[model samples]
Target: MKSAILQEADAEQFAEAGFAVLPGLYAPAELAALLRTVEQAPVSGPNFRRSQEVFAIRDMVGAVPALWPLLDTAALRQLLGQLFPTGCQLVKAIYFDKPAGSNWLVAWHQDLMINVSQRTDQPGFGPWTSKPEGVSVQPPVAVLENVVTLRLHLDDCDATNGALKVVPGSHRRGVVPAAAIAELTPEATVCAVPAGGVMLMKPLLLHASNRSTGNRPRRVMHLEFASVELPAGLAWREGKRLMM
Candidate 1:
């Protein structure tokens, strides 16, 4: 089995490319349990969205409380510990799934906004917006650089099944202007991951996905972790912290 610990090479890859994919992070039964929990989660939350093309929960672990216990598994903790030796707070979690024949497509963009509990007078933090999830604001560039995202795949992902496409080292340029993102790259690497694998990436990574051309579902749990605390009175919306 592939080790959950981030190796030296993996760390370098993340430092240079801003993303890395680790396959076979979960066992078959573990993946099954996650899918079952999500399937049974009540669809009665403001963050829940269901349509012909996609199923998503913005405040995922909050909406499905049962998911908290499931996520406390030892394997995940090991991986988190390697990244954040002291500890890391789970700032956000999202459940997203693209069903077979679903025409769901996402454009290349950086995850610059963060969902916070309330608006506070914090210098360098601005461009606030309200959404069903919570109050999302674009924090300082330093904050965005420290945000790490782990995408847990519940199904196989590939070029034909809407796998993510990311521009290598695009994050090194810092927050690229919206108009400059399109010019960031015409070259990207397809990050294919098997079921139960995890894709680790920085929040500033330029990533996108194409509509599925294959007949397979792509279900993923997107979890964000922050190693630093917010300034001012601002708090993470979820405030769900996990450690080994």
Candidate 2:
């Protein structure tokens, strides 16, 4: 765990840029151990989305228990408390690996959907989607606005290896149109983080990734946090309340 809180300047950067990167928070040994654990972690049955180009595991708490301690660390708790004073909990976890040969590319978009345990008719939530990935719904814009995402890099990521590209301050625009994304993405900035570093971002931040051209693996543990509660009996599918 890091010994100090995130710098106030970086916090301000996150507020304005909708994203921030903390470099070398973990040691090489720690990253090696984590990588070994992730390589051995059990994945969701055959439904696991594995391909020549990439592999993804959702609901990662059940699939890779070794990574759960990340949210429990005192440094992480302090960091979350600093960013979200009202308190936040882990609502989702996903592991994505862009392998050398896979040619997967994600287009510009905002992460507006959330994982829920069951499909319920809730006002302000609409157009529920269910696929092999799981059940998701577009929650209220307020929910997305309050959400924060952390991506932990297990390997060095750079533009050649599909590092994330984000449009600065786009989260402030709320939900945007597809045409707006097409127009704004040209101004996106690539965010490259070293192995053992973490990238913090807002859910509404417009972002995307290009295909890996350098043939290097980019493995990341993506975690989402939210403090809001669901209405009715609907619950977060992978939610785990952190002990702060």
Candidate 3:
């Protein structure tokens, strides 16, 4: 977790493969506590529609006191610092659950935009339009660059249970064309991880998941962070802050 270690291996992985999966990032008891919290928390948003396939609850860190320790852990903080030496702040947190018999699959895409607090013609922000789905079009590069995500796995993951698939080194190219991806290798690598492992990935990386054929469930706590700076008058939602 030292800066030297992270700079040598973790940062290299992020730059070359767009992600890094660090095993045993969380203790077994901690993982169990997180799962329990998710099971009891209120379900909200479109993420809850397919409870068996894809169920997500937001603001988990603030809701679960047990998880706050991870925020200050020396190893984790050092890794984050190495990942973003400039400084970073928590942007969002959510618990993602993929239950058995779940056929939810996410298509390959980039996390290139953010929901603005208000409408604006800001040059680096967006196409600036609202939609029924509540998602805005392409936001500025600065916003995307400031963001990073941590996906902590509470259960073992494998291809049978829809482990994440990502294109190595995809983040460097920015957003990839859908047609172009079809021609590239379907070499979707399976991210198999034991319980208590964590996967850190860039928001722009091309990643997705497949249906779960195994009887087990895949539970993950996703925590996203970004630098404090915002364009002009934009602001992050309250209670989203989880990091200094």
Residue 193 of model 1 has an lDDT of 91
TM-score of 3: 0.83
Q: Which parts of model 2 are misplaced by more than 4 Å?
A: 1-4, 43-47
TM-score of each model, paired residue for residue? 0.96, 0.93, 0.83
Better of 1 and 2 by TM-score: 1
Candidate 1 structure quality by residue, lDDT tens digits, 119-228: 88689999999876679899999999888899999999998889999999998888888898877768688999999899999998999999999999999999999888
Tens digits of per-residue lDDT, candidate 2, 60-139, equal: 77677876764355657778888778788899888898997568899899998998988999889987999765789999
User: Which pairs clash in the backbone of model 3?
Assistant: none
- The CA-based lDDT of model 1 is what? 0.89
Report, for every candidate in turn, its global Cα lDDT versus the true structure: 0.89, 0.85, 0.69
lDDT of 2: 0.85
For candidate 1, the 10 contiguous residues with the lowest summed lDDT are: 1-10
Cα lDDT of model 3 by residue, 97-128, tens digit: 88878877888777776654556465656666
